[model samples]
Target: MAVSGGIAAYKSAELVRLLRKQGAKVRVVMTRSAMQFVSPLTFQALSGNPVHSELLDADEENSMGHINLVRWADVLVIAPATANTLAKCSHGLADDLLSTLYLAATCPVYVAPAMNQAMWHKTVTQENIQKLKSHGVIIIGPEQGDQACGETGFGRMSEPLAICNRLMDETPTRCLSGLKVLISAGPTREPLDPVRYITNRSSGKMGYALANAALKAGAKVTLVSGPVMLSPPVNADLISVETAAQMHAAIIGKAPAHDIYIGAAAVADYSPMITEQGKIKKQDDQTTLTLTLQKTRDILAEVAQLVNRPFTVGFAAETHDLEQYAKDKLTRKNLDMIAANWVGRDLGGFDSEQNALQVFWKNGQKNLAMTDKNQLAEQLISLIAERREYERGNKNTA
Candidate 1:
């Protein structure tokens, strides 16, 4: 599956052939503009199957074409996913054929974005990518290099072969077999009313990265998420919430049933106690919008306090003084460990795929340097595996 208006949309035919050569089924779905770059007949000949491009085709719906196409796949991958396509998938805004399939797909979804360096760097685009990850959508790459648009930086589609290999590789690992995990992600919206709210810029990237990595490791993952404009990850059970209160209710509802819990959501620390019924009109004088903010329930802390709590982890996105804050959170929140990073920098941790980490635990500390979030996420999960094992042993001995 490929989205529209991307220069790299032309490479998808070769992608189809490579998959067929590996003895896997091949199907293609393209957006309207993608047809402008390449013909559906080209892909149909390559895959030996009809190419799908529309959601509203009366002929196909009569035969249940989209549902049939959706059920036919072990995985759906979007190569050269345009930012616009990414946005639709991120927030359940499925206004196109590919987006509709993404919403309707029961299998794993992978997106390889391609665009100019500048468009990729825009905060909106990056945040949309994070939202998709939070939804269990595995992001491949927009590798940094020279582009077809004569610009250079971080906006190239991962080579088709690389995307195909990585998709196939998900079947081998059973790293987290028999492990049940609970994860929370995104920024909790603290609502003043149905129309207004307070929230953060947490695009939910780190948590989603961890969730995808956990799945690749063979864990049964449950994601309790906030108001992120992203799609649900493929194969993950998703619980959606808006406010911190709602997030708390969802977490408390499920925390006891899992073997591990990672509270990665940036829950709003405070919320407005009173809200105007309608839009507050402008005032000439300095009108202090006295939002009587109240503290939100501490999700990780509550989990840590449980009688037989699962291994708990937390994330701290800081702007300065990383070491102190990370260590403090480790002890204060009583997390097994915490991952901290200095946000608001150009190193690309927040809305960017590449991220760095300063992890703190009672036993030791480690500096996880800047790398692709997917790679870093795998490393983080490995560490969690060891930590979880050690804690289990310690509990049994006690």
Candidate 2:
């Protein structure tokens, strides 16, 4: 474990304790300025190992300690990685003990950044982050929250337990290998006119994360996405759609050949019964103008009713009675699984970077607590794969 200088340096102590509690043998290395925030003794006590802070300590370096540190580590994790540390590591500068280990370490490196929102958004910092990612560093959260700086956009380190869980889940098995996955994502627009439409704030992050996870698990992935600003993940075929009608048609056309179908899109429930050929002219005396609506295609229910349907997953974003509504939808639509989350809140749904999911099947249920969409997606995919295999076993026996 490496700790860099930041207000979040204090949090690293707890992180070390959490890692050790999880049976990880933790050896902590701190930046010089990090010692100012929390003494090296704190980490040493928690990690149960000598804290390394400098590259020139003769007692520790008598046996090429820097190289030895790199060799001893199975995985290197840097929490509270400040802007300076990120810049140094990104540019391959090995000026300090932590940065030196970053250069020398052969194992996978994970970084959790902590800084002010402004610092994180700086062009140089963003470029450095991208460079680190390009070099295969697993960049974890700078999750959105109230930062120590008292301003919040997205520059807070993830909580210690979340980081610990991710470390445990990082090396998951390729459980969905050789399967075909079809996923729907983003909010489907219900157009009222050429420029006006009804849609939810579904950012599509959850669905995109699922697609990426399935691809990582060696599944052939096809993502049918509604309008979103996100780029498509590599190796997954992307089909872009706009309106609910178009999304429904695309899914219907392509879902039959896939082995798994996940309808993560928040498809519009209704569309205008009569669309105006042109924008309706405003009348000076008009006080109320009413338009009728008709139900949009229920894509999940349609897929579920197929005679040779794929293993289908649905998502329900609810504002009230989350689990009850989710279970009702699951049974009513006859879906293989349903992942539900509460929307219309300040966090953990819709456009937020993190979310919690309550997954439901017929006789079983699991709660995936709040975390980044990527980790949540990985867990969801793994659960689906496990259930799919279990069903297969039961079918063979029957």
Candidate 3:
């Protein structure tokens, strides 16, 4: 693991601990600036090895630490990869030990970027990132959220557990190779007037994570997303929608060509029967207002009922009776699977980074304990792939 200079450098320490806990043999390499936020001794204690930060050290083999470190590593990871380090690597400048090691390493490389929101959105920084991707380096999160700089956007380093899970989920074999996946995400709005709308608390974290996981499994992905602050995963076909009706249309129109459809969006159950063209004005005598609501289309059920439906997956965010509600929905909608989790909780629900799920299908269920949404998404995708293959095999034999 390579740590660069940034406030997120502290997160790298936790990442090292997670990697160690997962039984990985970890080695730490740091840029000189990284040590400003975190001490080398801290990493040395977690990694159980001496930390490497200098490009040249007299005590090392042939006084060449970069070459030796590259040889010793099976994979190279740079967490909190600052803009400077990214630029250096992109331009093939190896003035520092971390960049030199990146150039020297033969193993797979992963970079998790962390910077201010403005810096992350800069054209030059994005270009550098694209260059790294073109060279086969895996880029992880710079997730959207509050940053140490008192601004909010896409510049936070992915959580330590999420980064660890992503590293662990990496495999040579692509499970969903050649498959096409369609996913819906985020909370759909139901407009009452030109200015006001009804929507849920969904943050679309899980859906985005699933899209990324499916992509990692080598599937071609289409993400039909509602309004969200997140940056869509690289290489996905993104279709943006704002309302439940629009989401329904997008998903229905695109479902047939897909091999898998995961309905992760929280579409509004109902919408105003009549939408006012202009904002409703307050009247002096009117203290109360009433409006009728009509049921919105059921996207999951419609997808499942298609003549040649894709393997359908649904999600149920319940406040109570999770198993009952989930199972009922699975049967009621003729879904292949349903993932249910408790909402209105202190942890692991809408708008939060962590989540847990009780996944159900006919005669089977699995409890995925609360964890980072990214990790959970990877597990769920694996399960979906396995179940899909099993069902296909059974059909062939029958």
Query: Can you write out model 1's per-residue Cα lDDT over 275-307, one digit (the tens) per residue?
Result: 668876657896675668878788889988888
Candidate 1 vs candidate 3: which has greater TM-score? 3
Point out where model 2 deviates above 4 Å.
Answer: 1-137, 140-169
TM-score of 2: 0.65
Candidate 3, residues 1-398, lDDT tens digits: the string is: 99999999999999999999999999999888999999999999999999998899899859998888888876789998999999999878899899999887656579999999999999999999966754456789889998888999999999999999988978424688899999999999888898999999999888988887787677999999999987676678999999999999999999999999999999999999999999999999999999899999999999999998999999999988889999999999999999999999785889887899999998999999998786688789999999999999999999
Per-residue lDDT value at 194 in model 2? 75
RMSD, every candidate, angstroms: 6.5, 9.3, 10.7
Model 3 error, position 295 (Å): 0.3
lDDT for model 3, please: 0.90
lDDT of 2 by residue, 45-118 (tens): 99999999878778864756778898897788999899999999988899889999998875657899999999
Worst ten-residue run, lDDT, model 2? 130-139
Q: Which is superior by TM-score, 1 or 2?
A: 2
**Highest lDDT scorer:** 3
Error of 1 at 377 (Å): 2.1
Full-model lDDT, candidate 1: 0.81
Angstrom error at residue 321, model 3: 0.5
